[model samples]
Target chain A: MLLIDDLHASIGDSEILHGVSLEVPDGEIHAVMGPNGSGKSTLAHVLAGRDPYEVTGGRVIYDGVDLLAMAPEERAAAGVFLAFQQPVEIPGVPTMYFLRTALNAQRRARGEEELGPVEFLALVDTKRRLVDMERALLDRAVNDGFSGGERKRNEILQMLILEPRLAVLDETDSGLDIDALRVVADGVTTLRGPDRSALLITHHQRLLEHLVPDRVHVLAGGRIVRSGGPDLAVELEAHGYATLDSPAVEPRTASAGTASIGTISTGTISTGTISTGTISTGTISTGTISTGTAR
Target chain B: MTAMTRPATARRPPSGTGVGMGVQVPERAREPEWLNAARRQAVAWVDANGFPSTKHEDWRYTKLDSVLALPLAASSGRGAEDGPGSVSSSDLPTPQLGVPRIVVVNGGMVPELSTLGTSLPGGVRVESMAGAVRRPEGRFQQLWTRRLGGYPHALRALNDAEALDAVVIDLPARTVVEDPIEVVFVSMPTGDARWSHPRLIVVAGARASATLVETYLSVAGAPSVTNALTQVELGTEAELVHYVLQGERTDSFHFSSLEGHLAEGSRLSSRLLATGGRIGRHEVDVVLAGEGSQVDLDGLFLTGAGQHHDNPVLVEHAAPGCTSRQLYKGVVTSDGHGVFNGHLVVRPGADGTDAVQVNKNLLLSERAEVDTRPRLEINADDVACSHGAAVGRLDPEALFYLRSRGVPEREARAVLVSGFAHEILERFGSGPIRRHAEELAAAAGLIVLDEDHCSSGAVTAGTVHPGRGGRAQ
Candidate 1:
């Protein structure tokens, strides 16, 4: 369902991914493994259509539409999801309120009937218990004051709720303990279906052992030098990046759309304080008390 | 004291004869020598300052033609000869628990309706301002005279000179009172112009605690003008929660000045609900005296149909480790106007101090208006402080959200506006006071929460579903 040709991208003036390409057929898992600066995160951010990252040269195709031709929110409504490497905090807005708003926003875009509070609350209740998150956490501001593991767990909960068709898991297992790792891995496993495809981006072979990938690609110097089965993760983890293809050899897709694109943007918020002011006065900063229009 | 020698800038006397008739500051006799001297000085200063007009910032959006045009003189009022009419507490509030309260009628203290608390904490002294002056209260002479007159308030200084009666309470160290102390002011007006000034000085010793409630009550058919000054003092670790409710007569004008000092680690929470009077002005000044002290200042005002209410408040944090918060809300309708000016000052060297001030207003009519400003002055770099003022319509989106949920339009508007004022109500800390304000707002015709005003399920998220806001939540 997802196809990426020789993609070359860059954030700003500098290029990150030279020419890297990959594809995930229906109902399959593809894992991208790389060293510290191999652009593992760059790929995920590029796919989600994060701005500031100039797609200097490349084309990305998902299903039959050009994935690059949509806004970030449009991509979201189109079923493209990217689990952040670091969840952000948004203060003031309650978790439940934000979730419902987002769900409705997507549903409206899709022209689907929105769910009522009763139905929405019921769905959230079932999902909360599935990830062992208490209802109190959902009721409080999103990700505010949450521990490292809790934020990761909350991300999984959102992933489950959004139910994207093409899910990109970026460093989802970084801060998890043994128990949390299994829970996260289990969430991913349960989400897999015949019509959905997922791309796992990771640095360690440890998480690979849990959510085993059907195909593995070794990334180095902004290029995917080699490809192998799940064993490739174990090999790269133990031996490192010495076997990267020579300079003469082309990395992958030569077209511009699917590359790392130099820079990246976008982050999540826990909650937001809407403290809005809608005074109908003419000027905001310098209006005289003459009219006292604020009243 | 006469109006001719008074400063040219002082407020012009109400045109012709004011609603107070023609009575001005009254000249008294047989009064103590010191009391008479202060009044002369006050009336002179007022003549100089003159009542401010729309041309001035503080009075912006507030009209003074009818107010300034009144023909007021130098005297408060001729006690017996000049009389607007007769009024009583019965004309104001419903009778209460025969808890005898000292009633001040037409600027005169009527001890006939007063009594000493049956069970008073030892060292707790409560009496009239005149009574204290008569007996000297044994307080150091320098402490009372020097500080009071050295920086006397223009109007207060004048009121002090001619004022007839007041309430004073002094609690000794470590004394904690179990019952509330109430002071009722009933204005009985006569003649053209009448002014009543009730001054209170409350001193709480170190570690002492007390709750003082001062209520302003005016009867029907009696139109008058009242100017009251109340002061509070706290010792180290002492606590005080003072509340004031203004329910004066319809034709009356009310002005009060509240000044309090909070000592080391001491705390104070002061709230006022001003829903009466054609024109009302309340000014509160709170000074944080010692380290680790905190103050909660809240005021809620509702005005309708030609009524004007103004609250000018200040909270000063002087020492390190002190905190203060202020929230003021107002709901205005008809051609009424509301003004809220809050000032928060954090002095230098006062580190670790946190201060926040906010003012919110809801205008129920296109003709009605509100002017809100939260001013913050911080000189210390190590502390945190902020102030914000917002005046807006009800949240259309939230309104829609509530409507789609089965709430009717009118009922939803009422509910939404009520929620807008909820924060201040919660801090009012008085159940009866809160309910009274809500009922007053509804009765003024700003909203109709009654069953007939709203249809069940009139509020829905989507079309045919609920509120007028676009799209569903």
Candidate 2:
């Protein structure tokens, strides 16, 4: 459902994603594992149409539409969702209010009737149980004073409510506990269908256990070095992205769209494989990327 | 005292008569002697200190050049339209709260327009100041006798001297008013700069509880100046919810002062929403006079294009175990100006005092400016006091978050702005008053709220649905 062709993005003068080539086909969940500063979150943000990152080259085609040409809201209306790694705390915007506005905006954009208060509330109540979100939290300002686990769950709740066609999870599993991870995984699984697609960006393979992906692509030096079945995650979990030195050597079987682009753009491929330990523990400064890093 | 001369740019008198020099004090044979003397003394004070210049410490950020240039010496009481005659009642911005309301036209209470009438509840007295002073043996004498913080402000003294009538709400001991009493001051100017000194005197007896709403509105873009003053006394253990909504014409000047005295264990919540007036200035001085008293002061000044609003609040902690919280927010756009000055004073021997003051402003444009000062004067050794002020544009991440959720940029900004004002609006307390304040915010273009949100008693997120801002193609 989503095709990214040699997407090169830069933050200011520093180019983070040199040539990211990946694809999440319809009805499949693809996990993107990378070391620190591999532009994993940069890909997610660029997909979501976040500002600050200049897409220097390449195009993103979602369901035959030019996704990069659309505004953030337009992308959302077109069924593209990005679950932020760190949800922004909006002090005054109520969580439920924002959700309903978003849901209605998307529905309206699709030429569907807007849901009234009663209908919206009913939908929210049904979705609330899916993520075990407290009703009190809905009344609060968006993500303000919410714990890390609750924020992750809140993101899942939004995902369930919006029910987008393509979902991009950017390091959502970083700060969540096991239970929250399970809930998030269940939410993603429930959203799985023939028409839906998801791209899970993570630094570890622990989340792969809950929501096993159809494909696992090791993203290193801002390029997908290897693509294999779900076993690729297990292999990386045992060894890590440090073992993957060569780039684009694996058979381009991730998707039909990626198979055409056999040779990924050759940029400065650093052999300095920043360990996942350094990626997860310390702050990784990737130019203006909203990954697992503090904004 | 030195006899100060009028400045080169003082206000021009309305006519060649001494009456228009200030608020014309009405003379009746049966009026109390003390009131007449107080009025005379106030007039003399104004004559000596004819409106402080910008050099004055208190008037530093506010310039009265435009206000002084107008012919505002004539009071609204005389030669004005009779009893809402000129302006139709439909033109008034009345909040449909379904409570007992008193309508004052140009500083004079019109009995025909007021709804209190004989339905006024027992143990409660809602009358004009003209009527209260004639009672001879009421609490109005004592409450009006005491000075407010011993600081005689220039505009306040002018209001005292020139004022003709006011709304006096007297709640007896232990009386709990179920509904709020709303006083709407409708200003319909007669083709000139008319000054209306509207006063409100509220005295809640011991253990009594009541809610009061004072609304100031102008009609037909009138050129007028509304000099308003409110004196409140909350008796021991009494509670009072005071809300002031100022939505005058952009060509009008609104100057309001509120003096609150809280007794032992009393609680006072003062919320002000200023959305109108070319230059709106409000001075709030609240004194925690007795032990265990608490006060919550919240204000939101939403201005746009050629408008300036200033709120200077002073909270005096005179007794021990008193708590005072001040939260003031402003939204300035398109060259609009907003100012907030919060002064907190903890008196000596007033230990165990907890005070917090926060002032936040949102400047939407580069020219939109806000001058905020949160000053703290701590005299007591053991007191928990903190003051902070922040002025910035809307959060970009928050805007992106909203937009990324399919909300358009304009609607997303409206949501964030509404949310920013929601903190202060929620402090208006639940029920119709809060709804009215929300409606006022929406009307001022400070926030965008839908119909469902307006009718809801408690403003919930469930009710907020932004307008369909150009459905994403």
- Fnat for each predicted structure, in order: 0.00, 0.68
Which tens-of-lDDT digit does each residue in B189-229 have in candidate 2?
65454677788899889999988888998876457889888
**Interface RMSDs of all predictions?**
11.4, 3.4
lDDT of 1 by residue, B140-235 (tens): 222234344433334455455446655668899999986666666765454343556666778889999977767786654346667787778889
**DockQ of candidates 1 onward, in order?**
0.03, 0.45
Q: What's the residue-level lDDT of A16 in candidate 1?
A: 67
Q: What is the TM-score of chain A in candidate 1?
A: 0.81
Model 1 bad stretches (over 4 Å): A1-295, B1-30, B54-57, B61-63, B71-89, B92-100, B137-154, B430-473
The top-ranked prediction according to lDDT is: 2
Model 1 lDDT, residue B392, Cα: 61
lDDT for each residue of candidate 2 in A7-75, tens digit (9 for 90 to 100): 888775556676778888899999999775567888899999999888999889999999999999999
lDDT of 1 by residue, A184-235 (tens): 7877888899988888888888788898988998766566777889988888
Candidate 2 residues lying further than 4 Å off, grouped into runs, are A247-295, B1-33, B78-87, B93-99, B117-121, B138-142, B148-151, B448-473
